[model samples]
Target: MSEPPKERVKYIDTNLNLPYHYYAGDYKALYLRALKDKKILGSRCSKSGKVFVPPVIASPETLAPCDELVELPHRGIVTTFCVVNVPVYGREIEIPYVVASVALDGADVSLYSLIQECAAADVHMGIRVEAVWKPDGERQGDHTDIRYFRPTGEPDAPFESFIHRL
Candidate 1:
């Protein structure tokens, strides 16, 4: 019998655009509303006294419903961070930026946000940073309302200050 030739497999590359709507519950709606005003709001748990930024409906630790809303300062400490060097889809910022976990003042929970206006090498745990808001007209009820955080030139926070957040 004669040998038969093998056929090679072909691969097809494609992209998909999915349109969908996200429903933000009352807690998130209020939080985003405050963002539009260039303000950060946190939810406080009466029992545990933990405050969550981007306010939550329930206490993360105890899972108890939280009802009190507290306004938070834009300034916070960088509890930890890492530099982004690799490019990935859906990234709006330029490559090599720093994403840090911040512990805002008066809030028990920490919020994660992009760190900017400083050298990546200069970023470190406990660095003080304050939000740089977008112009009033540019805000759209989102976290992006705060363009990014910049160095406040304040002394670094002691490890004990933000350890619980970690």
Candidate 2:
């Protein structure tokens, strides 16, 4: 005899509210706190000598402990980027803004950020940009303290300068 048809699987659409305290452990706490001063921080891998921005506790490449703190320059090179034509929720930015992987000076890893103060067409790999920070009084110990990165009009860095971070 033929078996009865199996029930179809179903998914429920539900919204759950989750609120909790975010604890930034030592490595990240230091990095976040430096944002208030308009400074960027990185953690150096003790074994590999690589510096990572928004510091990680360990090196992703070598799994070595990152125990040293290093200051990074807000000026960075755009390793790669894309023009966003779609709108982001809660952000009032005009469409077609640029987003990029910024390889800050003295850091081995790159940070992702919005690129502004220039036309999207002008943004390209190796373009030099610097952070635009919020006014000090409004600043918090958060990455948001840097409103965005804008063109510095310096010459573009050569591919060799940031290719590893890409």
Candidate 3:
């Protein structure tokens, strides 16, 4: 019998490395502390009375350095969300999950994160959520320290309750 043509495999290489001199200011430290304790922290603008998570160093409106660090409630309500069926490079997660914007209690702005432990079909706008924190030793002082948010067994809050925070 004659030998059939052999197919050749192909590979592509892209060199990538962590950036040098990555800096996280005091606000980052505060965020880390919150993660360690299974709490959410936000910075409140003293003048405009606005709160920001991932705690901005300056007020988005007034452009002033934020002074007050407020610990937000673990519970939150989903403001918006999208189902992610495609995975990107360097992403350590499963497919078909929901990426949601959650407005934590007592904060003026919503934060973006993954909504896990449920089917993508189950995710919806205005669903109640709670932080699923990592164990103390597992925390790495970054947003991922919380792992992901899971559905909280609570009724969704009225839209009016969180509209202003958006």
Candidate topping lDDT: 2
Ranked candidates, highest lDDT first: 2, 1, 3
Q: Which scores greater on lDDT, model 1 or model 2? A: 2
Expressed as tens digits, the lDDT of each residue in 24-88 for candidate 2 is 78878888888988888899999989998888889988999988888898898999999999999
Candidates' TM-scores? Answer: 0.86, 0.87, 0.80
**Model 2: lDDT of residue 6:** 80
How does candidate 3 fare on TM-score?
0.80
Residue 26 of model 3 has an lDDT of 77
Candidates 1 and 2: which is better by TM-score?
A: 2
lDDT of each: 0.88, 0.90, 0.83
**Count of clashes, each model:** 0, 0, 0
TM-score-best of 1 and 3: 1
Give the poorly placed runs of model 3, Cα more than 4 Å off. 1-19
* lDDT string, candidate 1, 11-49, tens digits: 766788999998999989999888998879999987798
Query: Candidate 3's residue-wise lDDT over 1-166, tens digit each?
Result: 4875676556768788877986688788878766776767888887788889878888979998888888888889888889987898999788887899889887888988899998989987778999887887887666888778899879988888887766
